[model samples]
Target: MSNGWNHTAKIESLSFECGFCNNKVASDIGFFNNNNIDGLRARIRICPHCSKPTFFLGSKKLPDISPGNDVKSVPEEVHALYQEARNCISISAYTASVLISRKLLMNIAVSQGAKENLRFIEYVDFLAENGFVPPNGRGWVDHIRKKGNEATHEISLMDRDDATELVTFSEMLLKFIFEFPASVPALPSA
Candidate 1:
């Protein structure tokens, strides 16, 4: 078969995970000649559905967060989830961001000793009851909760504004739980 590059070669559809829509897709990339003409390779580096370019990744590295930031003391799993949520937001995956933010909240609560096997609402209650989250945080948390619920149980997609708001709240929650406490200096014994 022939494609965009105008070459006769056997083209195969490759599956891709798109960052933009947070969906998996298959695309037929066009074949191209190797740098030294030693071999041929297919280069379908764009997602057909979203029209966003995709990477032929060999590996992924964790994004850098500044050393002095509160993210350092954050538990590994929670931090990972939070970063992924941000990644989704960056790529306009608002629905995924909302959902991931909700997951981040649950992870925070659990890390702070909230009980397991509780609903997301119960997790909110647990966080409040245990003071893992501040009184001021309740409203934002609830906002994220409801939005995430809509994204979860309903056929809805959050907008950029909503995702940004929720992600900002999630960042604040992380700092409140991890960064603020670590900034205090210990008092000398009398």
Candidate 2:
């Protein structure tokens, strides 16, 4: 014997029956289809008294959401840093460019699994190890870090040529940081 409620089928719609007037009321309730493996399940409410369905309430389908592959892709934030560094270079603000490049490198380093509060020397080491910067470029990084420090700390005069050189170095470093991922292998067990 098959009961009326035995079959689990997707409810297409529902209506209401008024107990007092003994009249069938077509409810405006909505129904949503939950498409699952067993069958489609509907979200709806029924009037208890008259044992009649009422109100076609809105329905929703289960979304097939998943994490995107871009998470594993190169970080786009690095590109923004590159642009800022490039802009600083274009304006002949070499000191500013160098500072921005350092920031960009730090960002890249962290994204590549560097720990927080990494020292400047450690950053230079990582860059050199990853071939992101030349070993001799340590001086450049040091100079920029010092210039940045001076710009922030001391009231020293900054020359245009210095700024221009800083910008050039920043551009070189930025290029290296952005392109190094393609050449390097994935991070190993540390």
Candidate 3:
């Protein structure tokens, strides 16, 4: 079949988790090329669910579309918000990702016993003052608040870098507050 690359090769099909639609799909080969001498291969597959294309060099997908690593031992509600923020980045929804990252901080604070209904900045302060925000991480955590405010109050769009930073900081914060604490063995009974 003819493609934009003007290459002729047998069409192939493969099953993968579609990054665009987040579905397991059997996709048709949209394009393919191989260099036998060096064993390099490039391919594009059309996701049946989203009708979008995923590019692969050899077996690795380009622009990795997976969300950030899951934080162990997070509260169920907090984990959901974290996943939402991470998923937004996977789909290039940077603004939504940043917004969700902001919310995730509040959720984390509340789950860790901070009172709800306080001002947004208060939630950040709660995290910082209570030792949830890592040492030297105040700057990074504050960046999320500032970026989130800009995305919320101003006429501007959050970009991929902004979203990635916010989400990554959130991941580290979650690990510090929930996962690491959960891993510590309990002291022997007094």
Backbone clashes in model 1, listed as residue pairs = none
In model 3, which residue pairs have backbone atoms overlapping below 3 Å? none
**Which digits, one per residue and each the tens of the lDDT, describe model 3 over residues 11-110?**
6778888776778888664767644213756777877788887877677664346566878999999999998898887766889999999999899989
**Which 10 successive residues of model 2 have the least lDDT summed?**
62-71
lDDT of 1 at 115: 81
Highest lDDT model number: 3
Per-residue lDDT value at 102 in model 1: 89
Q: What lDDT score goes with residue 72 in model 1? A: 57
Q: Give the lowest summed-lDDT range of ten residues in model 3.
A: 1-10
Report, for all candidates in order, the number of backbone clashes: 0, 10, 0
Q: After superposing candidate 1 on the true structure, give the runs of residues whose Cα lies further than 4 Å from its correct spot.
A: 1-70
The digit string of per-residue lDDT tens for model 2 on 32-75 reads 34443235354443433444433222332211111111112346
- Model 1 residue 181 CA deviation (Å) reads 0.3
The per-model lDDT (C-alpha) reads 0.71, 0.53, 0.82
